[model samples]
Structures are given as structure tokens and as C-alpha cells.
Target: MSKEIRKFCHGAAVAAMVGLTALSASAEVSLNVATVDAAGTLRNLAGNRLHTLLREQDAGVQVRHIEGPVLGNAAQVRDQVAEGSVDIIGTDIAWAAPYSNFLKATSFSFVFRDQEHLAGVLDSAMMAELIDEIAAEQGVRILGAAVLPSRAFFTKVTPQRAADFEGLKIRSPQLDNWLESYKAIGANPTPVNWNEVFLALQTGLVDGAHGLPVDVQPNNWHKAAPNVTDLEDMFGVHVWMINETRWSGMSSADQATLVAAIDEVDAWMTATAEAESLSTIASLLDQGGGVFITHNAAKREAVAALAGADKVVAFPEDEREAMRNKALAAGKALEGQATWWAPGVLDELQSVR
Candidate 1:
């Protein structure tokens, strides 16, 4: 979503949203929601679904889903929401780092047992309130849950052994979660912007790529880095936000109704994305794009061992320990509330806890 020049639909955006500053009780509550992904993308579909759910909250609630660069890039939308110009927007959790310490803890290696484990922690009421309390200061409130699913690695050359990734340049975001993971695997981590990822891979600036399958599919990264050896190093979660002023204007009954609907939409979106992501790999191969490199039990063990043995280089040892402890405690607390977990995911959660 961040890779190219923005084409904002200025007039179209303004047309879609009905401003809500001073509305009569006879009028509906208007939500001006924005997303950076184009229509048909997972997050966009999720946002659209969110719109449908919000309207169902009450006859008084109405939603407008303005997508793409119509609201500027994701960062601009964040600012607009803070200033109360936009009512809602969706973005990655990286944006929440400064808002919550628990979010900072998400970067630690092995913090999540698996995809569902990661979702469980993020959807828990504790984390939800923590994010809301922190972000409320900025005039934005965390609305609900969003899972971008887990991220994987792909390369131009296949790695037969785990250590084969050593010294290779792997493209990732500049966050410690990504940089330190690749460094632990012995790769030279290259921080690259989202839009420039295709260029880096095609030009060989980076030998391997890291991102969710949904992310790389539309960007056509599979064509450049064709050897996909799955290594789910971390969870890719998104943060849903709404302007605090808008939320505050609503009555208590209205707020409760909207929150419940948002939570339901979040669960549906996460499940849909998970199913679609699994199908993306097959389509990539059908299109003559990449071979799936299977990492057998031994190779998988080797990868786990490497990450487990990875030293705390990006963060101070004491801070790393604190993050891990907080992360685990958060996960443990969410175990019971993970009703949306896929089959057998709870068992995995048990092992992690």
C-alpha cells in the first residue's frame, strides 16, 4: 500500500463522508472510515465488512468506507483521525509502538506461539484497553482487533539448511522484530520501504523477502523471489482506530453496540484472510512464479534452535527480558478468551503457556 505515488480522490472522498460534528437526534451517526488498500485487498474487504457491521449496530449509525489514497497514505490518515477530520482508519501495529509498551513487547523473538496465539494476545480485553488508554491521549482510540496474519520468508535461491540464510540480504521493515529475526538467522537484514520491495528483489539488492503472503501477492514479489521456504518469524497484526472525539460524542448505549459489532467483524475478517492467504501460494505456482521449498523436520528444528539461541543484540538484555515476561503474561491471560482460535490452536497455546 505504501509503494507508489498517491492518487487521492479529493472530491470523491468528500462526497462519501457526511460530516458528523453537529447532527440532530433524528439524523444518523456518521463514521468517515479510511483505508490505504485498494478494493478487493484483504484489509479493504475487512474495512468494507466493518462498514456493513457498523450500520447494523443501530439504525442511528452509518458508515462510509473511503479507500485507497483518497484519504492520503496510511500515515496521513492517522493524523487526520487524531485531528478529528477522519473518524476511523486502519493501520499496522508498528504505528502503535509509541502508544503501548505491550506493543513494543511484540517484537521479541518467540513471543507468539503461532498465528492464533498472536491473535489471542492482541484481541484480549486487557491489551485492547491498554492500547485505547495509551492512544486516547493522542485523540485516537483503539477500536477493535485486526490480524494481518503471520509473515514468512522467500528467496531467489532455496536454503536446504537453516544456516544457509547466513550472510544473505533479507528485506524487512526497519523494526527490531524483523531486523533482529533475520540477524538471528545469520542474514544481513536490509530495511526497505513497502513500495520499493519489488525493486529491491528484482535488482538483487536483497536476496530474500519477508512479508505476509497477502502482502506480496499483489505486489508480485513471488516473481522476483521464487523460492518460498516458510518461516513464520512473527505475527503481522493491524490496528483499527477511531477519532476520540467521535467516540466520545456517542451515548453509552451506542458505544457498547458499536464495539460489539466491530469485534464480530474483526473475527470474520481474520478468518477470511487466513483462508485466502493459504490459497495465494497455489495461485503463485500456477502462474509460473515460485517453487515451494519444504523445510523438513530437521531443518525446522535448526531454524527454531537458531532463533532460540539468538542473543539480545537489538535491545538491552534487561529490557528484552522485561518485554518477554510481559508478552508471555499477556498471552497467558488471553488463553481463555481465544474462542476464535482455529482447531488445535488452543493445544499449541497450552504448550507455549
Candidate 2:
């Protein structure tokens, strides 16, 4: 429903109107694509890029973009894919967690400090192992992954110090890891879905929000709750995936086309995210928005204290801690490396036995 998506959809419709329909006939296979985010977001960026590359390769693949609720909500879209009704989807890691722990590993405490660290660690051998594990267990084929902007803290009531959160009700996703993450970070977390966020802040159902720039800027939440704290505690993570049955049904040539197209999208996304994150944050502030708080070492430390505390609500608390510890160890090993941007962290995450 965003202006950009509307424009694309309109242009496609217009192209058909003008008798450009012959070009689409070259498609040997066509697939449906959907994303929950608006057009300008990283999710849609990946979606748009895939659509172009697949077509350019005349990969015989026609991709249709179904953005926002046109197809369904996140849960419904994912369910459709699992049922083999929806061909492909672009979804963030948090929403994909019910599928497997591999999807949520990116969200584990401090696993990724910034987009650079995220790009670095995700490009590792360890991540490959997890991706295949999830595919085997969950019956989905992960085409590729991309790093979203880091989720930071934004509040209406500027905290003079960390203790000011006595009654603070910051909003987070309904997912348990996010709930625990917000609680662990020292604020009263109010579980809310993405759609309700703007109104939640507008009417004071919540005090502030903890999400990435796309979440805030697209909805104009900056007009309501203006102060931002750059904790950079977690990177928003998303994966491009297809149902396993559909994936296996495709010809190897078609499959190869998808892999190549997705690789191109991933490369473009990594660079664009690094360039866009800061400027997007500042764009919100330039037009009569709110104040940007310098980084708060104390609040970050407070959140770091709870890392691997066994408090994750998604799985057994004990099990969650063990999972987090593994991620923390791997993440710690990756810190301050100049090799963060190097490609091919692993070609194909090792296959599952």
C-alpha cells in the first residue's frame, strides 16, 4: 500500500495495457512473492531486486509482488508457504521463529553489534549449519538472508538515566524473545504487533518503541515519540524462502536461476543497508521530529548483563540460555575483525544428516 509499491503495481498493470505482455511469456515458471513490510524497507528492497533479476535473466520466472496485507499477515503468509500454497515469501527472523531456532539465532543477545558485524557473522560457517538444520526440520528452503537495520530504543519520555524506566512501557513484537529482550534490557515491555505500533504510541497505549528505522519512519511514529537511543543491541534479520516441496519440484535450471538472482539481491542489500541506516535515522529528525540521544553505555550494559540469562520465553528457559550461550560465544569470537565484509562466509551451510 506504500506509494512505491502502488507505483510498481500500477506500472505493471499499465505495461499490460500497452501490449507489452509478450515479454512475460518468456517466463517458464511463475511464482508469487510477498512481504509484510512497506516498499522502501529492506524486505521490499529484496523483493523488488529479486523480481528484476529473475526477469532480466529471463529465468523463465515471473515474480508477482504482494506487499503488506494483500496476501495476509505474517503468520498467515508463512502458513500458506508451509502448506505449499504460497510459492515464496520474504520474512524477518522473529516472525519465522515458530518454524525453528535457526530463524531466531540472529536475535540472540549481542550476536550482531551493527550491520557490519551482522554481515560478517552471518557470512560464517556456523550460520550455514543452522540454516540447513532449520530447512530440514521446518520443510522450507531458505534462498538467502539479509541484515535489516539495527533495532534501537525510541522514547517520548527522555530518560535522564537507566532507572527512569520504573513504569516505562516500551513496545516490542508479540514474540517471546523480544518480550524477554525488552525486559532484560530494563524496560517494561508491552507486546504489540507492527500494525498497532503507530496508534499505540499516538494514544499512549505504550510509552515508546524499540524497532528499526523502517518501522518508525514509514509510519511517522517520530512525530509522536521523538527521542532515540542507539543501543544497536540487535540487528533486524530476514530470510527469503520458499516451501520445500515447491523448491524440489522446480527444474535444476530454474532453481539455479533463483539462487543467482537471490545472490545478486543479497549483495545489493548489504551495501544499501550500510549506506541507508544512518541517513534514514537523520531524515526523521530533520523535519520537525525529535531529539537523537547519544549512545547510552549504561543501558547497553544493563541489557548485556542479561545475555544468556536463561530467561527467553520461546523455549524452556534453561534451553534458551544454552542456545544463547553458543551464539554469544560465536559472536564474541567475531568481534573487531577487519574481515567482516568478506563474502562466502560459507557457500552452502553444511547439509543436514
Q: Per-residue lDDT tens digits of candidate 1, residues 228-287?
A: 565444667665778877877875545555666666776776777677665665555445
In order of appearance, the predictions have TM-scores of 0.70, 0.72
**TM-score of candidate 1 on Cα atoms, chains taken together:** 0.70
Best by TM-score: 2
Model 2's alpha-carbon lDDT is: 0.59
Model 2, 67-95: lDDT tens per residue? 77677777778888878888888887676
For candidate 2, what is the TM-score? Answer: 0.72
The reply for model 2, stretches above 4 Å from the true place, is 1-27, 165-167, 296-353
Backbone clashes per model, in order?
1, 3
